[model samples]
Target: MIRFAVVDDHMIVHDGLQAMASRADDLEFVGAAETPDDALALLEETRPDVLVLDLRLNGESSTELCATVRRRHPDVIVLVFSAYGNTELLTQAIRAGAAGYVLKDTNTGRMPEILRELVRAGSYFDPRIAGSLLLTSISNPSEPVSFSERELAIIRLIARGANNHDIGEALNVSPHTVKFHVSTMFKRHGVHRRAELVRLAMDLQLLD
Candidate 1:
């Protein structure tokens, strides 16, 4: 089961999501919190696979919270569950290390599948907000983005047009692991496709 938690201030959202997860065989609603502090504590207690975070907690953006969760709990995928579709905010969330962003008004029924896709691919963006954010410039162009040695190896293989299976064979890791690394790179550069990722890596001279 995909263990998950929520960090929304609204009681209704908490109750609703708990109900939704209880119905899904593969999803476990591990816990919920109302603020960033409590969310941190809850994460320590539960160590869930995913975190369903609200973009705005008590009328303020939770970009900082997202970043903290990511830095502290790198294995836990943060999925922003927000009502607003502001492109700037979405871009900020992505840059803050949110692995998935889904609008509250969109179909909640697909959330299970979305969460699964996120765990498998390491990223997901709602179709509504994806196009504009894809075109938006990175929030901080001057910020240096570095990759681990393993990630660099995957990038070199991708640049050579190796598929995930080929890359897996070359690296002696599973194809799923290779795809996860590629998708994380896509999120890191704010790009959605492999070609975009490769081009950005080249522009950044990361492939050197």
Candidate 2:
């Protein structure tokens, strides 16, 4: 069974998701929270395999929350379920470790199947934004960056907005190791902040 948790401030969303999960034989509704902190606590207790999160949680940035969950519970997959379809937010969520992006207007009845596909494939994007993502990917040059394979891997995660801790967990390395690589990359690229590094990566087409 696919254990699932939800984080959304809307009671209706919670109720709707609960009903949908209950109807699915392969899905188990673990819990729900209206805030990121509460969601983190619930995740700790339930250890759900997947978390359906709202992009806006009482004004809190969901991208940061997604990164937090990924850092704390590396095993859990986060699927962003939001009403907003802004490309910036969608990109940010993916970079922050979300495994999928689904619109709130999407048929809740189909969410169980969507979540199943997400877990099986490791990632998914709402069809609305798929074309935008494809265009963005196509716009990026195909030239490779002048870095070692490990460094390139780190750069890709960095471009995805991952912190040292998140990158460490994803790559199965120590945070210190991630930090060392990040610092080296910083010196090589003459950039100090994570945002700068991400911009540089984009300009150089270092992330495919």
| TM per candidate | 0.65, 0.66
Writing each residue's lDDT as its tens digit, candidate 2 over 1-208 gives 9999999999999999999988989999999999888998999899999999998777556778899999999999999997655455566788899999998889877898899999999987898776665665577656333567798888788777788899999999999999998898776444567665555554334566
Per-prediction backbone clash count = 0, 0
Q: What's the residue-level lDDT of 166 in candidate 2?
A: 92
| Model 1 lDDT tens row, 1-208 | 9999999999999998899898899999999999999999999999999999998788567889999999999999999997755555676788899999998887768888999999999998998778766555455555434668898888888889999999999999999999899888766555667765555445345676
> Which candidate should be chosen as best, given TM-score against the real structure?
2
Which portions of model 1 show Cα errors greater than 4 Å? 136-208
Question: How does each model score on lDDT?
Answer: 0.84, 0.82
Number of the predicted model whose lDDT against the real structure is largest: 1
Candidate 1 residue 29 Cα shift, in angstroms, is 0.4
Worst 10 residues of 1 by lDDT: 136-145
lDDT of 2 at 60: 52
